[model samples]
Target chain A: MNLTQGTADPRPANPVRVVIVDDHAIFRSGLKADLGPSIHVVGEAATVEQAVAVIAEQRPDVVLLDVHLPGGLGGGGREVIAGSAALLGSTRFLALSVSDAAEDVVAVIRAGARGYVTKTISGAEITDAVFRVAGGDAVFSPRLAGFVLDAFGTAPADIADDELDKLSARELEVMRLIARGYSYKEVAKELFISIKTVETHVSAVLRKLQLSSRHELTKWAAERRLL
Target chain B: MATIPVRPPLARSSDRVIAGVCSGLAVHLGWPVKNVRVGMALATLAGGAGLVFYAWLWIMVPTADEAARRNARRPASPIAPAVSQPSGPGAFAPGIASPAVQAQGAAAADMTAAPLPGPPSAAGASPLRGASGSSTADAGQPEATPWFRFRSMKYGKEILLGCGLLLVAGIMIAQMLGVDVPLGTLIPAAAVLGGASIAWMQLDETRRAGLVDKTKADQAGGWARLAAGLALVVAGVLVMVSGSGSWEQTWLALLSSVAVLGGVVLVLLPWALKFWRDLESERAGRIREMERAEIAAHLHDSVLQTLALIQRRAGNEHDVVRLARAQERELRGWLFQDPGREAGQLSDRIKAAAAEVEDLLGNAVEVVSVGDAAMTEAHEAMVQASREAMFNASRHGGGTVSVYLEASEAQAEIFIKDRGPGFELSDVPEDRLGVRESIIGRMKRHGGTAAILNTGTGTEVRLRLQSAGTDAAEGKP
Candidate 1:
């Protein structure tokens, strides 16, 4: 696997810059309170309206955006849903909702969220989402990940159709994660492969199957349960 | 427009005016009851309309209050016993006859109480006109007060009106469409249809439920009545306009105009309201009946089945009674929108239940709650089943009681898990109600089913809800 510790951007140096935008005040505060001095909560908002404003002003690296809201500012009213789509440079929105409703799961992701997770998600998982969204990586709750895969009707490189018949376990894992829409670099890192090596394996995969693009590849892999 | 007298003291029905609550408040309070209602209505308008009071009265007061009152004015004690039971004409006690017959016999009995809402002092007064749409708070108030007893048919009011209105509207529309028939030509049909519909609602419930089925016959009767009335009026018109045209032509022209006017007035009026409301009553009554049936079916499948299983397995234990107690609470909840007998809020109820069931069965039980459970069918089932499941898991499975409740318009599900020994299909105990009655029976009744699945380390019970039917059949295969 390719691993790199790129030097931290000096401009926002040291502590991770986080902004919590969950509608649940207790959850948002509890997260901030639990993360302790390790992470900085630059700003917080309880609803989409306030979240947008907070993101615009604070410009934190990560925004813990709750997918539900309470009492005004368009909690789940389908308004201002598009409000959080465009974030200032380097800032990312993470979805925090109660259920992994497909519409909602797809909405936040389509709205340019870094990740989509449910409130049932664990504290560790939530902390992971913040970092992943901030770092331009997609974070999804396990069920929510299924919803996203369902939403686009596509899976990542390693997974797709033909599972009922046969596929090696390793091949299955690779196909499933790839059908999940992971980037080549991400997939290679996850699967512990060198970039060139990943390219070679991908070429062998394409040639052995005669598939054209990654889209068809993911669809085929999903059909076989290879991923 | 006819003035309707809605049960008085329209504002703040905190305390019913004993005869004068309305008038006394209107007097000592210095405002007419009607005026107070109007102001309260205006406030409802000023704010967002659904302040709660208006919606409260709409369903509380029956539509035909005036007619009910007229019935109430009859001499008392004669029909009291029968009316008290709300049955139709011939209901017999116990071994005597069917409930339907008894109910039918008792049908006319309610007349005394039914008519009492009408003011005792307003006996001979002209019928009052009720306003059409109340402010938000007053949303469901009936727009018209019905007659004490419709000497005219009350049930047919709507169809007659609708047909008349449609005809009048059709006539107006035809006129609009450039038809030669003038507006006056449509009026008679409108009035006849309208008048007849209002006339029908004056009939009894058997007639209302469409159980009587003589409505079409009544329409014929109405037609005969209208024809006779038209004949005389036409004859009079002919004598007056004699020599203008042949007798046949004069008669035709006269009758046609009268028919049109009659249809318009009768159908387009409060008279038609009785018919319209009867239609609604029939529909609402059907819905209530369906809901009752649904509750009964679930109670049978879930609770009754569980009881049967308990009777088989362990005979009857303390836990069985506790489970039965929980089931009773659920049944009461189904019957009442708010069973004031509830000890605590829903969350507290579930929480305490989780703790109690765990202790009872000697297992760990936990509850995770989201969304409100008030009145939602899913919430009721989830809470009830979870209570039962907790007992089952603790008593049988030897695992912590875990229950999950979820609800949405399109779907609802209750999932439960308990950790202990896994259920063996081979060791099926004779008296195993936990599996039979609590889980399997309940979901089946709701058009859903329950299945036990292996959850790696423990056993999980999943109840999948069946969505609406009829609409499903429309889907192409």
Candidate 2:
């Protein structure tokens, strides 16, 4: 369906510019073909070093990043994000992976990736994710949703002032539904709420996932150095 | 018997302690060096003939390096080429030559190696025979059993010998300063100390040899050293007691000691051989484990990656995709089997059910799980309900079905969605209990909940079960 039709860029003339970063050339070409005409493919890279340079030179609005790449001190996608830290504000990153590792998704998210989706997702779903990320919204697959739910335990009513890292009651409900494989529209209908309300709850949870607490930020920083 | 002396060439070992004579004779006869040393010492003290024999052996036998060079130049006798240069590049290169050639080389080596030592544990001992029975007995072993470790004793024996020499030097220096020690007592005392040190060195060798594959020769060698050592000490004490004893009386004492010690070794030989055989088998098992690990690494690098590439490239062909996925699953299970987490877990059971439905109906079912929980009655109920949902989606939907499972410390949840024609809960009659009895009723009976909803596009089955312990603590069912 046309899930992101209404949320298109304000200037219709300017499509969401994206750079594809994956190790497989065949997969990259296939994704370029599948991304359709709405999103423009500006540059492509096969390794971490090449990805960083291409991302900087293209200055694309969104970067479709693979969670595992070959180069740059073996840090993979996280290294690419760390290398282009200055461009995180104007350029959003959306990680796509076929890896069954939860730590990889969490590490990339903590490294300032806007969202994560599996490579198995439909072309339409990936296309919609790119636009949503470009518009400053967070996208999470069912697997990532489950990870977030597990990361932040079930929320209690009336959150205390010091529990800033905990998810809210409404956000918990939305995340649980997503973890149970619900689409945004399906979750909205299931909860008798608007799709925009569901998006707001999810984005809030995404923000918490990225900057959970000072302790978590410190842990991520240490882990990055080890990588 | 005075038969042909078809022995491994008489080459003096570079791994030697004194003049390389005893160790060289030991290797040639496939006897432990300690036994050879003790025999030579006894014979020397008896008539002074052993010292002359040792001196002749040292001059006659060539060093291992010279033997290896001579063997390299020879055209016949492939056995020497294998044993003469044990650490050479050609030693362990398997599959390099034709099978016929290898068998011929091995047979030639085995004929000369027939009486080498160590029971033939595997097939007839294949080339590479020498002091380390490990190499002689098994050809498949990639590592050469280190002979120098036993022969040289690293620096332990050297240090012991050094200390003994220093003590002798100090005694001599004191005598030169006009101390009242008699020369007769000093000479006997030196013999006692020297024999004791040699015995001590062999004891150390026995302890270290226990970890490796110790053979009959090694055990006999140790026993020989201990017997020789005690005999020497006894002879020294007898001479000290009979001050200014005649040479004939000293000879009788040494001969009796050797005879008595030989009996003790004869009694212990059988038991020591059996124990060392057990150790040999244990080492063989460890080598097998290492080979398995190597095979796993090779398969993971080549076969597993190729299967993954096949699945990715043939994504549209359902049959090809299914076959590749099944192969990948089987391979991964074999390569990364974790004994602690098996098919009995809730997630594994559900995935197995999905795979059954897929294989039976030819419909694709994707299962994803996160955060496993302890298996309980409530968890079983949820898995049963999820299995029913997957089968329903596969049979009726005629398209791909997706199953998602997430579990926390206190609760577990499953969601099954399909791209099927939507069905209304109100549309079914009371008599139709497929959804009610199997899916919804099964969950309620176990203190869980199951729901069937019609998303505007398709159908979604959601099942959730809170742990019974959590339910009681919260006072909710």
Candidate 3:
């Protein structure tokens, strides 16, 4: 199913610019071929060093990242995001990797990536994820939401004070589900509410916690061990 | 008698202090008993030449009983003329013979008349002769017996000391009886007696036997030479001190004694050096042999088995290449590469194995390890079994596999858990050898345990290897 289809594409005139970072040459070529005309492939890299250089040089609208790569400071995908920290506002990152490991998902999301999805997603789904990330939205695979939540759902014990207690009960449930890497559709279904209602609750939770995005909300919650 | 046959001299059984050689000779030569004894004693005082002669006669002469037995065995042989002739010495004074001597003569006559079956046995009859004969035979075949096979050297020294004391007693008795023995002659006689006894001790049968074995001979000869040199030095000092002479003469005597002792040591140096060298070489050879055996065992257990597996799967070119590459890396690291730097931590080794399984089965594995454990042979076995369990999980469990490792000084435990449908242990097909041989069997061989528990949620393979005591139930997840 195309999870990102319902979202609006802000850059329709200019096809979403993308740089694919993966260690496997075959997977890079296969992903480029599958994206077709809907998305524009600007550049590609096989290592963290090359990924940072290519992303900075091309200034792609969205970078499809792999969670594990061999060289260049050795933090895998997190190294690439941290290396190009100045470009994160204009250029977004969406992690696409073969690993479904909770640590890998939490690690990349905490490094300012907009979304995380396994490599098992269809070509249409991946294209939609790239457009949504370019449009300033967070996307995640269904099961991976729990890892995100467990990693960053609440403030740590020392910081678990008035800010977290300000969130309403409904807003708190929506915040936990979204920080856990759940899609808006998943959070709405789990809480028996409308998608619009889920989004409203998430916005309220973010405003109360003074967080900027779902990625930050997840990190803030994880530091508090709320999941 | 019509004819007289010449007979070899025999030790007479009667009138014997030790072997009766002097008494028998006195009888045969028709000399006065007192004259023969006095003459021999005087000869011993002159130079100890008489002692050497006595030792030789002791070896050559057969005892009276042995001689008689030989005669009886050959009845047709002509009898000795001396036997037919009446006792020559002391024949006129028959009353002087002791009752013991009469009894001995009667026993000898009775033995002569009996027809014995074999050649005359010298050593077989006398305990002394039996001991001496066996020791000499042992000396001939040194390798056939241990070095300490006989304690004869110690006993021989005791016997010599007794002989020297007896000579001293005789001198005292002679002086007390108002015989007026010259002090000059008595002193020389005592020196000669002591010298002869020391020389006799040098020919000990056990020492001769020790000389036949290289290691034993070196030790025995070294001590013997040192003792002899020290004795000679002491005697020379005594002689110089007793001689009331000039200081220049005493100085000359001391220099000669030191020179003699130095010469003896110089002669023994090469043999001692050779023995020391042999011992060192033997120790080195033993160490080399042990190292070679250890390397062979390691190759047989790991590398050789991998090579055989590769050969069997030649039809599958990918598996063959993978197996070949892994074996090559392992062998090269073991043989040529220095392990000091690249000795992998246990967690790293387990992660590497997991990577290999992932490549083989095309599945993702997450390895979570805590604590750095000393990687020993037992830990190696545990790692190998954990790899097998992971492979089985990826292939059959049909889901992402998770490997957890907890290691401490007391034990190392690895858990390979898969979030797939669990099955009973008995449900495994009979033909499948992966779980049975690779995981369970490997753990058991390492004095450890492998338990497969179907927890209803997922299958967990727990491999535990203890270093010291019974298994601990901690760290269960």
Instruction: Tell me the TM-score of each prediction against the true structure.
Output: 0.33, 0.55, 0.31
DockQ of each: 0.01, 0.07, 0.01
Q: What is the TM-score of chain A in candidate 1?
A: 0.61
For each candidate, the alpha-carbon lDDT, in order, equals: 0.45, 0.66, 0.59
The better candidate by TM-score, 2 or 3, is: 2
Let me know the TM-score candidate 3 reaches against the reference structure: 0.31
Cand. 2: chain B TM-score: 0.37
The model with the greatest DockQ is 2
* Model 3 agreement with the true structure over A1-227: per-residue lDDT tens digits: 12232442333556889999999999999999888586989999999999999999999989999988878866788889989999987898999865434445556766778777778566877887787777666665543433322222322223433344244456545644443234566567667888656645544433333343333334332422323
Residue B25 Cα positional deviation in candidate 3, in Å, after optimal superposition: 99
Off by over 4 Å in 2: A1-13, A155-164, A214-221, A224-227, B1-316, B327-343, B362-364, B368-370, B398-400, B408-410, B429-433, B466-477
CAPRI quality level assigned to candidate 1 from its DockQ score: incorrect
Off by over 4 Å in 3: A1-18, A21-27, A33-62, A65-84, A87-227, B1-370, B376-381, B398-404, B417-422, B429-458, B465-471
Alpha carbon lDDT at B301, candidate 1:
74
